[model samples]
Target: MGNTINRRSFLGLAGVGGAIFASGLSGWATAETKPGVANDDFFFVQLSDSHWGFEGPPNPDARGTLQKAVAAVNGLESQPDFIMFTGDLTHTTDDPAERRKRLSEFKKIVADLKVKNTHFMPGEHDAALDYGKAFQEFFGETHYTFDHKGVHFIVLDNVSDPAGSIGDAQLAWLAADLAEQPADARIVVFTHRPLFDLYPQWDWATRDGAKAVALLMPHAHVTVFYGHIHQENHHMTGHIAHHSAKSLIFPLPAPGSQPKRTPLPWDSAYPYRGLGFREVEAQRQETQYKIVELPVRKV
Candidate 1:
């Protein structure tokens, strides 16, 4: 039997103020299976681009948004197995002291989460200025790999170089990591920027992302989740799937939709319009994952 998810109850708890989208994953199985062993299903939450210290016309409630998201996640009827913040936990600041301060405050806010099994990465805003030194001090390694029930999770650092490149060294590390896994392993990658050249004119592409994709091409079941574009996007790199998450601070216009990649204007009537997080429920036996887009605040 497959694991059952109470979608309606989850959306109700998450305050489903926006549209909900779903996708499927095939050939996903547990890491180790023994006779009579059952494959259990689990879920995790992905929250990105909170921009904790941002203050601008794009979002009047900048200071309060991240808090609202934390409260919403805490309110979930079924707490996620883990939580992941793809990147941009704080806004960009050139001042070293202020940057660390913002990171500290962001950390403090999220500590309220009901679920403590959380993972983090960095966005250019939090890392580029100092090549991720401060972020590393706060969040540990920028790139790493961890195994869940049956899935291999890889967190790649593309923003730390300032040049927006993963660099050859990390690519080699990624290659070595993949080589140790079976060719048909169920792999998921988390990164701050899109691994493909979504739109290079606006600095949305990773410098050597193609190389990273090439190294991942041999894996049969691979998915990439990322944030930075500030909107939901889905794309395919051959057999691999890449999904981008929305921002908690504000949303940007669709790729190449405008001359500049600026945040969409704040709509006073519809506060938190384009800002939200997601819940990903992995049904291992069924070989699919359901993603629910949730609002920052309940209506």
Candidate 2:
């Protein structure tokens, strides 16, 4: 079941888009916030598909729009301890200087971010152009794991293959990495593309996503956070929940539902107002997390 909560009122392009609050069963927006990081408390930010290179249309000014999102996130009342950007950090093309310029501009824009920790993973646009060689140089390891608040966070690199699948080596590492996790411990996975067969025609789903999902089935509490869809949506298989983030760029049409899978025409009357991030909160031990989508807008 799903519910539409508060339309948090995000900035829309020239008053086109309005805030939308739709959620799944995990809907619980808390008024009381836990102070600091506790034994059973912690939250992180998820921002994806910034698309720094693209220009015009949906967003008349992509760079300006992104800057606005930066401001909105930096000014959060309860600032997240860290943030993760899922993918599509840059536009297409494999120019080394262009790549450096896009990344440098992105970093420069974020230099003013107040958050203490910020993590980044490459997407097809960033990785595919150079086979992720430059991506690794700029952003470091594509696949790695971390333990936070007793929760396991596995960031995978699924953008390498044109088919959008995790190669055998990464898959093997993931299985071994997750083999010993206890049922009670929370396991959260992050990637640029989705892990499900969302829409193969448009390259929305991960080809080898089932393998990853199978490995994750043993864990009681598992949430997979993904980007690249450029919009908010969710799907579930067994106990695991899969979520995709909204892009700082333009919104794409829903998967499979689209006739041609092209960038649907943005409602010109309501321009693009964006800069959104996802918030995942873990309450008491073993309690499912409270995930919230926070969209950034000009004040």
The top-ranked prediction according to TM-score is 1
Number of clashing pairs per prediction, in order: 0, 2
Instruction: Kindly give the stretch of ten consecutive residues in candidate 2 with the minimal lDDT sum.
Output: 1-10
> What TM-scores do the predictions have?
0.91, 0.83
Residue 68, model 2: Cα distance from true site in angstroms: 1.2
Worst 10 residues of 1 by lDDT: 10-19
* Model 2 error, position 173 (Å): 0.7
Off by over 4 Å in 1: 1-24, 30-39, 288-299
Q: What is the lDDT of residue 223 in candidate 1?
A: 88
